[model samples]
Target: MTGMERLSLRVSEMINHPIAQLRRSVTIHKLDTDGDREWEEVMGVLSETDELDMTINDDGTITLKWEMVADEYRQVEADEFEPEEEPVPF
Candidate 1:
């Protein structure tokens, strides 16, 4: 599976109820170009800021971790809306 898909699946499985915060640990296939790129795409979808925890494992895989809080999710949603480029008749 692609890195983005794998991460999405894991996060989906992790959530069992409503949550105000969550910590996600995603494993990246560091040696594979496609896998690495997929993880980059996944990173764009997460709410993490300029900081995240990364670890290199003996098994050669890289682990990326970040936490998401309710406030961050709200900000992400708010940022998704843009004002109309032009005025419209209401």
Candidate 2:
């Protein structure tokens, strides 16, 4: 399958998964050219569903919010993996 097809499959899975309803929103970051296209294509697919709304941010990120969720959070930079300064305390 093509990269976009694979991404679409994964995105469909995420959206259809049982726990997806629990998430207030999902942020997709364009980390590369393929990823960027994937985000755009996925957004198009989601637009047809009418169950979520997509917002394209100035920082090249796409945010998908569930229809039932309240919009209370402010947009922030796409989350990047960062090493924690302290170890987890158990």
Candidate 3:
């Protein structure tokens, strides 16, 4: 195989690895940009590799670090319904 092709295959294996079942101890280096510059560091256990290390450096940014947990897949509960409003006389 060609050199380029060999390299590509290796990368593909590392990324799309089927045996790459969810492994604990997944670290994430989050970097956010919204309000003032700030950072929140935390660790989490996840399966797929996170791309937190790939953050952009700039002002007005906030970074949150946390591992992806099965809880992340939890469904959000619906809020209680509100009563209909009556129309006011014109």
TM per candidate: 0.34, 0.52, 0.25
The candidate that wins on lDDT is 2
Error of 3 at 56 (Å): 20
Q: lDDT per prediction?
A: 0.57, 0.66, 0.34
- Runs in model 1 deviating more than 4 A are 1-23, 31-50, 73-90
Say what the RMSD of model 2 is: 12.8
Against the true structure, candidate 3 reaches a TM-score of 0.25
Give the per-residue lDDT digits (tens) of candidate 1, residues 1-90: 866677656544443224312445655543344465665665455435454576668996656666775788888888898665786768
Local accuracy of candidate 3 as per-residue lDDT tens digits, 15-82: 34443324411222333321122222112211223643323237523232334445544422222344
lDDT of 2: 0.66
Q: Please give the lDDT score at residue 89 for candidate 2.
A: 88
RMSD of each: 10.7, 12.8, 16.7
- Where in model 3 is the C-alpha error above 4 Å? 24-90
Model 3 residue 45 lDDT?
18
